[model samples]
Target: MPQRLIASVLLGHYLSAFTTLGIPLYLPRILADLAPDAPGWSIGVLFILPTLCTALAAPLWGHLADRHGCRLSLLRAHAGLCAGFLLAGFSPNLTVFVLALMIQGTFGGAMAASNAYLATQLKDGNLSRALNWTQYSARLAMISGPILLGLLTASGMGLELYRVLAWLPLLAFVLILPLPADAPRRQARTSDGDGDEWPDQLPNDLPRLLAVQFLFSFAMVVTFPYFVPYGEALGVGNDALIGLLYSLPHLVYLVALPWAQRQAANLLLPGLGLLALTNALQFWSDQPDLLFTLRLLSGAGMLLGFVGLHRCLSQRSRNGSAGRLFGWYDSSGKWAGAAAGVTAGLVSQSCGIASPFLVAGLVAFAALVLARPLLIAPREITA
Candidate 1:
């Protein structure tokens, strides 16, 4: 595990997340300019599209990385992202902008491929720590991108907004070019009796792990898309400030990850319990003071849940079925995210934005209830 390799993966993580954050920050602005009369329904649909695309595309991209070289797959995805940003920034109309975003999703799982590269290069003992750090880099990117864009958008640079946002992906593309490629792993997995395809006999534990990821991710999705609006209704109107609120829990989690791994040995159950509590707080909180307080609590809980989930996945991968297990984990998570996005969006449209959070909290509580059984069994390994 050379430092440069981790740096490279972390850098990629940052860029991918930065680009993803930029889309949402500018989304309201985009709608205002392009579809001023559009209702929540339209905005909600727009919100769901990218996640839907990513959900559909991630597995394919992961499979490609498994069969092809991770390095090539990564380079190709970055190139696609560069092109997608340019298209997004330069689109002549709304249709073109969204189509470009759809294309972006087509290349969306570069992060997964990048992670695979990290796992392959990292020594066993260091892998979870490295992945946790990688998660932090991404959290940092998400935090920075939205704040930067909000500042730029508020400055009224007008159409220059697109150009400014374009710089994130452009810089990322430049940074990624020099990173090392994953050496071809055992001559690459191929089809038809080559024993090269992704592993066939995934351990039963893999599905259980994926199920947990899906449930947790669903809880996240239920509230994430609607939280900004909910906060606004409670009189917290600053976009950058709201972004800060949204991100702080991740910051807490980022700070806790190294220590949790070192001390807890098994962070999964407690993490899920905290997460469920956070969502429960959000579900009932609406008063301005109460909302902010719940948000702070939720953030802390999220830190535990997400970081613990990543640690578990990293540990699971060490048993020799890294590709299939991690891919299933990501796929499950993305599908959960997509389902949450759409469900929450539709619920918000019909029942008001707060409804989604209320429902989301209940779902998180249920996930917490069931998580203990899923993780209680002894760890298992794949051949």
Candidate 2:
């Protein structure tokens, strides 16, 4: 693979990360300004609408990529992201803003498109390494994007934040224009004598792998929304420290990339085991120091699951089907993330802020119990 290709993907992913995470970061303010009369339930629904749209629409877009070409598909995602932000920035009312975000979710699957494009260009270890690099870009953005936005706000550039954000994806779109194109590898016909259509390389046990994806994703992301609050309740006072602790898993991934590339999907099982133990243990940890240790351990578990799943999919990807395979793979995660956030919110309200972690731990344990043969068996290839 060309270094320029990977660099191009990483830079685009990092730039888009702002829009991905930043919009939600400031959504409360945006909602208050646009819809002061909006109900509380509606606010939560609006916050999650984009994710739900993405979950439902990813496969359609992926199939389009499989039929046409990945390069065009990637450009379509960037263009969609650019258009969505532009609409959000210039919207005259709340309805337009809502429509704008829905469009964004339905179209702007840049991460899935990027991974699919990379998969078309790579195989085996190279594929896994490229996937890890894209992850690194997002992790790096998670730590820095907030600080960068904060600095801009401090400088009084916070007015019409969406307007400022629109430019980032536009820039990313232009950056991707020069990368190599991946033409589709279509089969001439199926056994039924169909015309030229891309056939899927699906094995019988695909649902099993997807189940593991959903459970693992749910276990990990279910903790995200309430992590800071959980830390505060545990007597960790510094906001900066809390931020760092919340980011430990991402930070750990950065430091462990070299090792992670070597291990790949092999980490999934042990990772779930460690995550379950640490999350359950956190419930009993009253001291800040112990919470700190548990958070770090949880990060390691997350790293294992992330690498393991990506590599497994990489190995499963067959010619012409990377887009569809990775897209559906991501939809499982998208659905899990949305569900996890809602579950965490409800659990924290009814139980305690710490209860979500316990819930997440149990989900991981259950997944581990059910995931053995589906996850650990040798790759089920398509001819």
Candidate 3:
């Protein structure tokens, strides 16, 4: 639990996001230049395609760590990200670019790798706090990565720009390379009986926890597709305001971390319930103030729910399967987000842009019901 190691992990994670999110953020312009004749719908498919690859390939990362150990696994992810970005940077055609994106998705998962590494080194509440900090790192990256990257590339998705950006992940790899090996920290925990427990020694079944991850992730992310449009629908004309609405949930994680962490167990149920309510309330108000308030509340719910669910899964590290467990856990969320995006697109086409919020609300309510037992304070917390 060295502060230096924890800070390094967070910084590495922040850099990794620049490479992982570039495709989704810049695909439209990239496609416009490379494949102008391509159909509009293909853009959406390609946007989600990399995510699907990540979801499918996630469990493999776990197995890698189980065999090679977490430090190597994390370094591998950073190197993979650099390679993927380099490939995309130099891609000569749409085929190559798409392949490069797939490579990035398939190989890059520093966030999950970081989790596995941290889970190996810490336990109980300390682990939870570290995971929460990781979440902050991730949110900041997601919110600012594209804007900064866009400025660097001039939004061009060019060879030189991408190649330059590749250094970020390489930088991450270098940051992690200096950290202590996993065996020592893991051994220390094992001596305390943490390493003696079973990988399945969690509060509930692994599959059940995975289920909550999927549902909760789905509900929380379903708003992504239409938040700007929903804001516009509410008569918010300022581009900045629309952007703020979209970012409020992420900002909440930064602003309310201490309170949210303290009340996470209590917030878990309400947070899921809030996602449901906020989405439903989206239809009830066209007032910008009310919508902004709803978005703020939505952000609070997300923080609570995310921290709680992560703690629930972090307990599985007792048996030293942190890599695999977190890998699969990462997959579950990716799959859910992809599903939510696809579903949102289809539903929005027929039902209206705001329709997805209602569906998300219903999904959130169902997720709340499913995740209730895990949120309750119990003997399983320290396992």
TM-score of each: 0.83, 0.92, 0.91
- Evaluate all candidate structures by whole-model CA lDDT and list the values in order: 0.67, 0.80, 0.79
Compute the lDDT of residue 30 as modeled in candidate 3.
72
Q: What C-alpha lDDT does candidate 3 achieve relative to the native structure?
A: 0.79
The reply for model 3, stretches above 4 Å from the true place, is: 153-159, 184-196, 199-204, 264-266, 376-383
What pairs collide in candidate 2? 265-308
Model 3 residue 61 CA deviation in Å: 1.2
Positional deviation of 373 in candidate 2, in angstroms? 2.0
lDDT score, candidate 1: 0.67
Error of 1 at 272 (Å): 1.2
lDDT tens digits, residue span 1-383, model 3? 38999999999998887667653677777777767888998888888877888898879987677556788889988998898889878887888978887888888888789988998778877788888888898888878877776786584444556688789999999999989776533453455564444443334467767888898888877778877787788789898878878888989988898877775344567778877888789866767788878889888888888888767765556535677778888999999999999888888889988888888888888888887776553535233
What's the CA error at residue 133 for candidate 3, in Å? 1.1
Cα-based lDDT at residue 61, candidate 3: 84
Better of 1 and 3 by lDDT: 3
RMSD of each: 4.0, 3.1, 2.9
